[model samples]
Target: MPRLNETDRCRAVGMIEAGVRHTDVAIQFGVHRNTVDALCRRYQQFGTTRDRPRSGRPRITSNRQDTYIRVVHLRERLRTATLTARNIPGLRRISPRTVRNRLRERGIRPRRPAIRPVLQQRHRVARFA
Candidate 1:
């Protein structure tokens, strides 16, 4: 079932307080009757109807580490993702793909440095003439 935001949960609680039945509130809000009951129980347990913290997969790197990655890439614009990943002390164990993903998130795209053939002054003069 889709989750309700704080505002919707608070409104349902208000409806329950105003003598509305749980089923009626559920139908009006398009949520499950059990959800309404749970929201009420949550409000009774905790005065506020805020959502509890959810535990999800932890990030491979911290915000500081991400900033450090951005700084390293910014300082050396031509550096490759694999090289950057290897050089950062904090990101030693992380994959180069993760480093590239981080750079992509920051609007930095991975690109090969431009390669230009060397031309002597005589070559340039001959081409112009």
Candidate 2:
């Protein structure tokens, strides 16, 4: 199951604070009792339902740059990643593969569409046969 969102987390914490039993809260939220316990503990410690800062190398592209990338690709859906990479002013230094990666993150994939002749009524009858 997916992790609970902020609303669900806050609701769970509220119920726990209202003197609801941990197991009962868990049942009501459809989560394990330990999950409820941990959420309460986190609330007590941090006093916030937001996630902690994650450790890793930061992204190469800013939100604006990513938006530019998406827009450029959307404008020319059939454009190759190599061409798209050259098109973006800020992303020109990055690899075409990186451009493709960003596009993939936004659920855009470039593929050679299937090539088939359009079917007429005779072709449809032949398929049924």
> lDDT per prediction?
0.86, 0.81
Q: Which runs of model 1 end up more than 4 angstroms from their true locations?
A: 75-80, 100-129
Error of 2 at 93 (Å): 5.6
Q: What are the per-residue Cα lDDT tens digits for candidate 1 across 1-129?
A: 778888898899999999999999999988899999988999998987998998997779888879988998898888888887777776247878888889999999765556798888866675543
Q: What is the Cα-based lDDT of residue 9 in candidate 2?
A: 94
Cand. 1 TM to true fold: 0.66
lDDT (Cα, 0-100) at 103 in candidate 1: 91
89 Cα displacement, candidate 2 (Å) = 5.7
TM-scores for every candidate against the unseen true structure: 0.66, 0.58
- Highest lDDT: give the candidate number: 1
